[model samples]
Target: MIAIDNVLISDEVVEEQFVCDLTKCKGGCCEDGDAGAPLLKQELDHLNNYYEVIKPYMTPQGIRENEKQGRYVYDRHFGWVTPTIEGQICTYAFRDAQNVIKCGIEQAYLDGKLPWKKPISCHMFPIKMSQSEVDPSMEYLNYEPREDLCSAACKLGKKLKVPAYVFLKDAIIRHYGEEFYATLDATAQHLKEQKG
Candidate 1:
C-alpha cells in the first residue's frame, strides 16, 4: 500500500492493468450491480437540486423510479446511492443509439444544463474507495477489476501497457487532485525501478 496524505492506495492500483472497453461491456458496471451507483453528499445534493434540468435526458421509467424512491436512496451498505430501475439500470442512466448505457447526469453536463458531471463514485470505476476502518478520515483506493465485465478492458490495458492508475488518470485527478496524481505516478515509477 502507498500512503499519500489521507489516502491509502493499494499497490494493485499501479500494478494491475485496466482500461474500460465500453463497446464490449456496454456500461455493465451501471446495470449489473446489485446496488445503484454510490453518491457523495454533494452529489446527492446535485441530484436533488438539478433533477428538473436533468429529467429530460433520463428515461420515463427512470424518472418514475426516482419519483417513487427519493432522488437518492440511502443504502445500508453504500450510504447514499442513485436509485435503480427495478433493481436493474440506474435511474440516472439512459441507452444511447448504439444500445450502450450512458449516464443521464453526464449528458446534462455535456449539454451545459448542469455544472457537475456524474458522481465521482461512478467516474472512478474499478477503483473502489472506502473510509479506513482504523481512521475514518482516511480513504482507501483499491483496484478491483471485475472479471465478468472488465476482461476485455484488462486485456486491452495489458496490450497498451497502461496500469490501472494510469488508465484512471482523469478520474483520480478529478477526485483527488493533480498533485496527488503526480505523487502516485512518481511513486509507481520508483517502485518499478526498485523491482527492476
Candidate 2:
C-alpha cells in the first residue's frame, strides 16, 4: 500500500488489480478534445522535445487538425475549453508489432534518455482538481456524475473498484499543496459526522 497526502491505499489499487479498461471503454482521457491538460514548465519542455521527435511520424491531416484548432492555446482567465473534445491522438500512441499502444516518452525514460514526464492533467483522469471560491476548498471533480464521455470513465472506475477518497486524495496532492490535504480530510470528517 502507498501513502500519499496522508491517505492510505491498498496495494491492489496501485497494481491496478481493479479492472479499469480505459482503452476499451473510453480510449483513455486523451480521446476527448481537451487541449490536453495544462502543463508545468518542465513538463511542457519535455513534451515539446517529444513533439519535435515524433512530428515526422504524425499524419499530415493530424498536424493540420491540431493547427486548425489552435490546440496549444490555454487561457488563464477563462479556464480550459469546456466539454473538451478529443484532439488528434498522439503520433506515438500507436500499435507496435505486438499491437499495443507504444509511447515514445515512456520508452525514452526507460532508455535513460529522458526523465519520466507527463502532463499532470493527463496523469490524473476520471479524478479532477477543482477549487471552490466560497470556502477556498479543493474538491474532487468526479466525472462519474457528469453526462457524456465522463460517464464512461465513472463506469470504468466502478469496475476497477476505485475508492473515491483514494483517487480524490491523489488528485488533491498533485494539483494543490499537501497542506490542502488535511483540510480536505477535516472537511470530509465534519461532513460525515454531520450525516451521522
Candidate 3:
C-alpha cells in the first residue's frame, strides 16, 4: 500500500487502469448494489439540505421510497446509506433519456440548484474505501473494477494509459485535498519510473 498523507492507497489504484463506461454500464453502479450509495457522516446534512431540490428530479418510486424510508436509511451491513427503492436503485436516482439511471442530486447540482454534487463514494468510481485494520480511523482506498459493468472502462483506461488514481484525481482531491493529490501523483510517477 502507498501511504499518502493519512490514507493508505492500494497498488491496484496506482497500477490498474479504469474509466467509467457509462454507455455500457448504464450507471449500474447506482442500482446494481444490494444497498444504496454509502454515505459519510457529514453527508447526512447534505441529504437533509438538498432533499427538497433533489426530490423534483427523482422518479416517482424513488420519491415514494425516500419519503417512506427517509433520505438516508440505517443498514445492518453498510451503516448509513442513501435509501433504496426496494433494495434496488438509490432514492436519489432517476432514469435518463437513454434509460440509464442517473443521480438526481447530481442533476440538481449541475443545474446550480444545490451546492453538493453527490456522495464522495459515488464520485470516486472504482475506488472504494474501507477502515484500515491497523487503525480503524485510517482509511484504505482500493481500486475495484466491478466485473462486466466496468470491463469496458478497464479496457478503455488501459488503452488510454489512464491509471485508476489519475482517472480519479478530482474525486480524490475532493476527499483528500489538492496537496495530498499532488503528493500522490509524485509517488505514482516515482513508482512508474522504478517499473521502467
Candidate 4:
C-alpha cells in the first residue's frame, strides 16, 4: 500500500495496468452491477440541483425510473446509489446509437451544462473507495478491476503500458489534488526504478 495523508492506495493501482476499452466492454460497468452507480452525499444534491439540465441527456426509461425512484436511492449494503432501471442498468445511463451504455451525467458535464462531472465513485471506476476497516478515519483506494467485464481493458492496458493510476489521472486529481497525484506519480516512478 502507498500512503499519502489519510488515503491508502493499493499497489495494484501502479503495478497493474488498466485502461477502459469502452468499445469492447460496451460500458458494462454502467449496467451489469446489481445496484446503480454509487453516489456521494453531496452528489445527491448535485443530481437534485441539475436534474432539469441533465434530463435531456438521459433516455426516456432512465427519466421514468428517476421520476419513480427519486434522484437516488439508499442501499443497505452500499449506502447511497443512483436508482437502477428494473434493477439492472443505472437510471443515469443511456444507450448510444451503437447500443453502448454511457453516463448521461458526464455527457451533460462535457457539454458544460454542469460544472462537475458524474459522481466521484463512478468517475473512479475499477478503483473502489472505502473507509479503512482498521482505521475508520482513513480511506482506502483499492484497485479492483472486474475480471469478467474488464478483460479487454486489462489486455489493452498491458498493450499500451498504462498503469491504472495513470489511466485515471484526471479522476484522481479531481478526487484528491494535483499535489497528491504528483506524489503518486513520483512514487510509482520510484517503485519502477526499484523493480528495474
Candidate-wise lDDT, in order: 0.91, 0.47, 0.88, 0.92
lDDT of 1 by residue, 82-190 (tens): 9999898999899999889999999999999888889988888899999977889999999887877899999999999999999889889998899999999999999
How do the residues 30-146 of candidate 3 rate in per-residue lDDT, one tens digit apiece?
988878988999999999877788889999988888778998988888779998887888888998889888899999999999988899989997899888668887988988878
Compose the digit string of candidate 4's lDDT tens values, residues 43-136.
Answer: 9899999999999998899999888989999998888999998989998888888888889899999999899899998889899999867888
Which of 2 and 3 is the better model by lDDT? 3
Query: Lowest summed-lDDT stretch of 10 residues in model 3?
Result: 129-138
lDDT of 2: 0.47
Instruction: Choose 2 or 4, whichever is better by TM-score.
Output: 4
List runs of model 4 lying over 4 Å from the truth: none
RMSD of every candidate to native, in Å, equals 0.9, 7.5, 1.1, 1.0
Candidate 2 backbone collisions, by pair: 32-85, 32-86, 33-85, 33-86
Clashing pairs in 3: none
Clashing pairs in 4: none
- The TM-scores, one per candidate, come to 0.97, 0.51, 0.96, 0.97
Clash count, one per candidate: 0, 4, 0, 0
- Tens digits of per-residue lDDT, candidate 2, 59-137, equal 4654555466543545464254311224445433434454434444455555666554345554455444444455543
Q: What does candidate 4 score in Cα RMSD to the true structure?
A: 1.0
Question: What is the TM-score (0 to 1) of candidate 2?
Answer: 0.51
